[model samples]
Target: MKSVTRSLRVLEAVAQHQPVTVGELTKLFGLPKSTVQRTLVTLAEAGWLRANRKDTTRWEIGARVLAVRPAALQGSSLFAAAREPMIRLRDQVNETIHLSVPDALHSMVVVDRVDCAHAVRTFHAIGDTSPLHATATGHAVLAHLAKSELDEFTAGTLKEYGEETITDPGELRAELRRVKDRGYAVNHNQYLQGVCAIAAPVLDGDGVPLAAVAASLPESRFASGLLPELGRMVTDTAAEITARHPR
Candidate 1:
């Protein structure tokens, strides 16, 4: 039990400060250097972290952690409900399609994705995380959260990833309101430079958000003229997923 507890602490530290060195983990945990080193070795052997080749003394999360997440997500009814619809949407718009769930307070994690055929396109694998403050999917999910949850979520710090990110709490609330009214959310080069996206919520039986769906493309291809047409396709796909999976 003690060993298990220590291992969890080490994992949390690595997750909080990844690509960190053993010496840094020791200082962060106030543990003996030897203990931190041993913990890091155990984590590496167990496929939780991998030492960096450029500097063997430093480590970052390994493939197993990412691989393990998608299996559980696939078992979810939401993922099952959203998969085919995502494929159809991707085919219709020929843009990168993403499906995410609000698994944490400040971000959503991608559980499934359909890559765009474009040679140059935005891409994120399953289990990748995106910040709530600066993404279209994040805004769509946030707009549909219960009022109490929304209040708690907004009370935290909002990171500004780009010039277009909505950092002020008041302004974020206003944006959420607009998103709710419009039935979808738009992110125009807000999270990443030259990337634009539109997203809509997949709702549960009570009409609260269960997940979100998005279509992303490079700003060079956004062609503002298509926003209205494409936005509806994205929302309609989300609505279809919501209807199939009410849980």
Candidate 2:
């Protein structure tokens, strides 16, 4: 039980600061240097983190996390159907568009992304994870969860990551209700500062949300007045993708 707790703590620390050094992780976790070193070695052996190719002393997320992509995304029709829509969304708004799916850990993981052709745009790695309560992509899918799943997901403490992140489950539930009432979710400086995003879910045949399609951009580029049309565009694109591929 103690090792299990420590393992999760170590993984959380790595998530917070990737490409980090063993010495830094030791200080961050307040664990002995030897303990941290051994934990790193164990985790590396188990394919959680690996020595950075550029800097041997630093470690980054490893195959175990990244391997989720090939299995979670590649074999599915969702991945194939999502590509053109993702590209279309990127071209339509010239903003970063991402496809994210829920993970077992109450987080949304980016399965694919279409980058905007701009000097500055939102970017996230394929396997990067975001808390369901704070991210637009997360809310889009989470909003349609069954009551039991919603209860289990919201039972944990919600961490505030950005200025406007909703921490209260009641408040989150209300916002999710709005998401369900509508067909999309919006986040303004909730996941990251100076960034705004809108997302819509791609639902399966029975109306279960399979994933979320998001358009993310810098706050300056995300003109407040244009939100309605932007939200509609994403929802429409998501609907198109779902229609193209049903279980």
Candidate 3:
């Protein structure tokens, strides 16, 4: 019984201070280093935690954690705030819309979506996750990250998902700059070869991104000329969601 309780506590601690090291957890919990290390290893084996790719000694929440809480956002303020705006965006653009939140710095997890009527539209399941540097939804959030956080992210490997994926850190940084300047991000077969998307960050009172709102369509239906129009619509929807979100 005590062992189970200890494991749960360790899990919660890891979540609160994610990417935390064994040494830090030991000091915080007043536990032996071996005990904390053992609990982390156990949780990692169970898929509730994973070692940070950038620093193997630090731990963070794993994909299984996001996978298990499929309905987590449904009851939240962000989901409620985004629901109407997302639907309206979908209707206006006739493209699939997604509402996603960053999972630490590793990925963006889709929490809600509004599907277009198009038979060949792009689709993302509610719990689907996409790489942070390989999608419009991700770039929207990354464009607003604090400098230190962005640096940490860039320091790690930027895995390529497709030919358009920006594996070069310098190039990705330049793209983020443009996203910030334009108040939105655009992806043309960056994450998926046949999909294209435009997205904007939903910022809080302090301008920190809480989530991203995106409009996605099949690449066949997308054209370079549509960027300005789609970008404006997505950014407007994101702003509406942000204004409606509770502080």
lDDT by residue for model 1 (117-224), tens: 999999886667889879999999999888898899889888888889999999999999999998999999889999999999999888888789999999988877
Error of 3 at 180 (Å): 0.4
Q: Can you give the lDDT of residue 69 in candidate 3?
A: 70
What's the count of clashing pairs in each model shown? 0, 0, 0
Whole-model lDDT per candidate: 0.88, 0.88, 0.92
Give the winner by TM-score: 1
The prediction achieving the highest lDDT against the true structure is 3
Locate the minimum summed-lDDT window of 10 residues in model 1: 10-19
Select the stronger candidate by TM-score from 2 and 3: 2
lDDT of 2 by residue, 191-243 (tens): 88988899999999888888899999998898879988999999989998998
How well does candidate 1 match the true structure in TM-score terms? Answer: 0.88
lDDT per residue (tens digit) for residues 1-247 in model 3: 9989999989878876788999999999999999999999999999999999999999998888877775666778998899999999988999899999999997898888899998888888766789999999999999999999999999999998888999998999999999999999999999899999999999999999999999999989999998999899999999999999998
Pairs of colliding residues, candidate 2:
none
Error of 1 at 71 (Å): 2.4
Q: Candidate 2 — which residues are off by over 4 angstroms?
A: 1-17, 20-49, 53-55, 61-72
User: Who is ahead in TM-score, 1 or 2?
Assistant: 1
